[model samples]
Target: MDHTTAETQLLDAADTLFYERGIQAVGMDAIRAASGVSLKRTYQLFPSKEHLVEAVLRRRDLAIRAELEAYTSARTTPTERILAVFDYLYEWFRQPDYRGCAFINSFVELGAGSENVAEIVRTHKRAFADHIAALVAAADLPPARVGQLLILANGAMVTAAIAGSPEPAREAREAAQRLLDEGVPD
Candidate 1:
């Protein structure tokens, strides 16, 4: 296989293993074995376990952001874009292999003080939240109200993950719509 394909296969293998098992539990040797790549090749791609973990997270972030952008593009109104996020997340929750937020799970495994992992997690989360905030701003909502709605939207994802159900996400979307309707100036 080509280099890009090999790298993608490695990341796919890592994502499955890391998400199902914890990052700490899956070692580089295991990833190499699973990917059917030689140790030398694996190390060449990812010098350390930390680098592999970051690659898995970065891949996931890119896929999720792409999904959000595609979903939002179908809607003309900001409110629809906001609600589309819920629809996107709900679809993800319905997948049989769904294992909640990778970033949140990784953060739990790495704990609070891990600088590199924490930076990756924080950056992904802020980007998602900022996307929602931008949509709220486009709807002409005040900054404070936009922040509140974004929190509600993000809270929905966390709640759905914990509950292992999409109901919490649906509830959050409804509440966010109500907040927007009431809080947006006329």
Candidate 2:
């Protein structure tokens, strides 16, 4: 395979395995096997498992941010844009392979020891919160209100993942609406 093809295959395989199984639990050999890329090539591209993990996370982060921008941009109002995030979450939670936020899961599993992994997770979350903040900008909401909305969105992902239901997304949307209506506390 060419360099780009090999890299893409490795990432696709690694992303699936890392998300489905914990990062530590998945070996380079598994990624090689799944990707059908030679072990030597995998190492050549990633250098180490940690490097590969970081690459996978960075790729996911960009993709998610783009998707959220696309989803929210289509809406006409600030409130609709904010609520569209939960709608996105609801759809995500209902996917058959849904396993909560990949960054959250990665943070839980690898953030303690791996600074690279932790930083990637942090960057993903900060970018997401910023996206929400941009969506609610026209509403004149406080920055803390953006934080609250982020909490609701992340909480919905965790709650839905644990409960095996998408109800939390809707509940979170309602709670976010209440917060938007009531205004943030000083």
Q: List model 1 lDDT by residue over 28-102, tens digit each.
A: 888888888777888888898888898888888888888888898689888788788777777877766667788
Each prediction's Cα lDDT score? 0.81, 0.91
**What would the C-alpha RMSD of candidate 1 be, to one decimal place?**
1.9
Off by over 4 Å in 2: 183-186
Q: Candidate 1: misplaced stretches above 4 Å?
A: 111-113
Measured against the true structure, the TM-scores of the candidates, in listed sequence, are 0.90, 0.96
Cα deviation of 165 in candidate 2 (Å)? 1.1
Indicate the worst ten consecutive residues by lDDT in candidate 2.
Answer: 135-144
Q: Model 2 over residues 89-123: C-alpha lDDT tens digits?
A: 99989998888889999999989999999999999
As a TM-score, model 1 comes out at 0.90
lDDT of 2: 0.91
